[model samples]
Target: MKIAVMGAGAVGCYYGAMLARAGHSVTLVGRPQLVTAVQAHRLILEAAGRTEAVPVDATTDPSGVAGADAVLFCVKANDTLTAGRVIASHLGSSVPVLSLQNGVDSAEHLQAVLGRPVVPAAVYVAVDMPAPAHVRHHGRGELVIGPGPSSADIAEVFSRAGIPTEVSENVKGVLWAKLIVNCAYNALSAVAQLPYGQMMKTDSVPETMRDIVAECLAVAERSNVMVPGEVMSTVLGLAASMPDQLSSTAQDLAQGKESEIDHLNGYIVRAAARLGIAAPVNRALLVMVRLVEAKAQSARR
Candidate 1:
């Protein structure tokens, strides 16, 4: 399959590297710096105490997605529509476009913009881009994608490429579950400037996470989204799952770049308000991350 990875950020780079290493014709469309670095030394995957170079084509043009058999849309949630617009004309009419992004509505947003089917995947991966061409993997890299005309085939393709992929009928619930998990951990890690394992060891962090998840579950209940599984257990288990990985928000703040905090906790806050439910914990986390972002922005200026 000719796969196109649209963002080339941490998640995009990790999956793209895996797919390319599996012998597929993979192309990464990213920033000029990434394209230049890849052209010079190739894409690097650092994981599990080892590293290897992945073979893939790289380009800065959105048109690089042209003629791709499948597309992985991996931009931040905030850039969903903008990136969708940029690549809409280039994607084939029937190609499967997977939104491997945070938040619940990216696929819906992209589908509207592209006027095509966009698969929504609940991506669980701990990875970060240490350099323009280097992606460091910390832990789990599984995808739970919602049903689509081509979801099964795509899932099989990913599985063959060493990516654990599952096709689920209750994708809405899956996305909501992921949103709640982010609500529990992301802001805390960002505020503490710590990885999951270290942050979880701090004082009263488990309690704080419980409070946050309680509020999130209330919101999910009010929204009538059947978020499956034992959420509390899942939240508690994350630190162990990706001990060395920092939250994406933390990475964004460290880089002095904007994050998808608004889409994560902020989305829950909005849902709570709309449903006449209280979400103070979620609201507080959202406010705190926004302040951090504001401070980071001011520092840059």
Candidate 2:
């Protein structure tokens, strides 16, 4: 399969590398820095106690997505529309765009701009880009993608590339389940500069996470959203599952880049408000993350 990874950050790069290693023709559309690094050393992937360099095409131009069989839209939640526009005219009309992003709305949001089918994928990967062109995968590279005409084909391609992919009719619920997990951990992890295992060990952190999960469930219920699974249990199990994993928001903050707090916990806050309810706990965490983001920005100056 020929694949193009748009917004080739950690999530994008990680999957791009895996597919490339599986002998797929993969191109990464990303920043100049990553292009430079890839030009020199190929795409560096560090995972499972080993590091390997995979030769893959990469360009700073969004037009790199032009000839792809599938495009993985993996930009941050807030940058969806902007990135979508950059690549809209370049993509083939029949090309499948799988949004492997942070928020629930990015796929549909991108589809509106491109006027093409966009597959919403619930990404279950713990990964980060520590350096230009270097992807350090923590654990779990699975996807629960929404139902569409091309979903089965997409899943087969991904699973063949070593990424477990499931086509789910309840993909929104999967996304919300993922969102609830993000709300419980992303802010706290970002604010504290601690990974999940370490953060869980801190006093009052588990209790605080429980509070966030409860509020998120309330928002989903009020919005008539069905969030499947034991979300609270999923929240509690993260410490053991991905112990060294830091939230993507944490990675952004650590690098002095803007974090996506507004889309995670802040999404819950707005949803609650729209339903004439309150999500004080989620709101508080949102505020705290914003404060830290502000601090990170100020210090960067």
- Output the number of the lDDT-best candidate: 1
What TM-score fits each model? 0.98, 0.98
Q: Please, what are the lDDT tens digits per residue for candidate 1 over residues 1-301?
A: 9999998899999999999989999999999999999998899999889999988999999999999999999999999999999999998889999999999988999999999889999999999988899999988899999888999999999999999999999988999999989999899999889999999898999999999889889988877789999999999999998888899999998898898998999998998898988889889999999999999888878
The deviation in Å at residue 103 for candidate 2 is 1.2
Report the lDDT of model 2 for residue 245: 92
lDDT of 2 by residue, 187-212 (tens): 88988899999999999998998889
Candidate 1: segments with Cα more than 4 A from true spot = none
Q: List the lowest-lDDT window of 10 residues for candidate 1.
A: 215-224
Clashing pairs in 1: none
CA-only RMSD, every prediction: 0.8, 1.0
Tell me how far candidate 1 lies from the true structure as C-alpha RMSD in angstroms. Answer: 0.8
lDDT for model 2, please: 0.91
Clashes of each: 0, 0
